[model samples]
Target: MATQLIELVDGPLDTGKPSKPKFRTVRKDGQIVKLRIVDADSPNFSADLTASFQANIRRARKENREIEDDS
Candidate 1:
């Protein structure tokens, strides 16, 4: 059995009002597994989210036995 992960990222457009990075994770079964929001003040929100997403995928893969990312 194999599972995949996906992340949906979004953010506020207003620069003055900083908001957390919006993202969601899904499995190969097309089920949403998790949602994460990075710090709004962080300068490297994109990088942080990307890293976190990768880590999550790795962890999920290890725990699920095997995961194939479709993202």
Candidate 2:
């Protein structure tokens, strides 16, 4: 029922102030699912993912090729 309305509008139908992301409800695996903003054609599941590790080696290489002595 709700899915049809969403599809007809190609997105949320709400037009309230302070526009924000919209989420809809659906049934998946016998459980209710909240469907948020997502592009089925161009998936972006990693848009909010952070880097695995810092680029320590890259930073070191860019700092200086020669070693400094403080003795």
Candidate 3:
């Protein structure tokens, strides 16, 4: 299987400074899924924003498993 990467782009943010962070979600084949800009001050910012990405991965894995099971 190819390696998957969910990497944070740019260096660590300074807490004293406020800025939106961009995240790069890459597929196992090194293709980029999406680039997301997240607001740090939003409620449940991390969980809310990443939920869809996580769900997509879960759904893909489930589909793959189903396909393999049928083989």
Which structure among the candidates has the greatest lDDT? Answer: 3
Candidate 2: minimum summed lDDT over ten consecutive residues — where? 45-54
Model 1 lDDT, full chain set: 0.64
Best by TM-score: 1
Pick by lDDT: 1 or 3, better one = 3
Model 2, residue 32: what's the lDDT?
100
lDDT of 2 by residue, 39-66 (tens): 3343332331111112335556656554
TM of each candidate vs. truth: 0.38, 0.25, 0.36
Pull out the clashing pairs in model 3: none
Candidate 1's error at 1, in angstroms? 50
lDDT of each: 0.64, 0.43, 0.65
TM-score ranking of the models = 1, 3, 2
Per residue, candidate 1 scores C-alpha lDDT tens digits across 1-71 of 89989866687433343334477787868776776667746877666666667668888878677444432
Instruction: Give lDDT: candidate 1, residue 59.
Output: 83
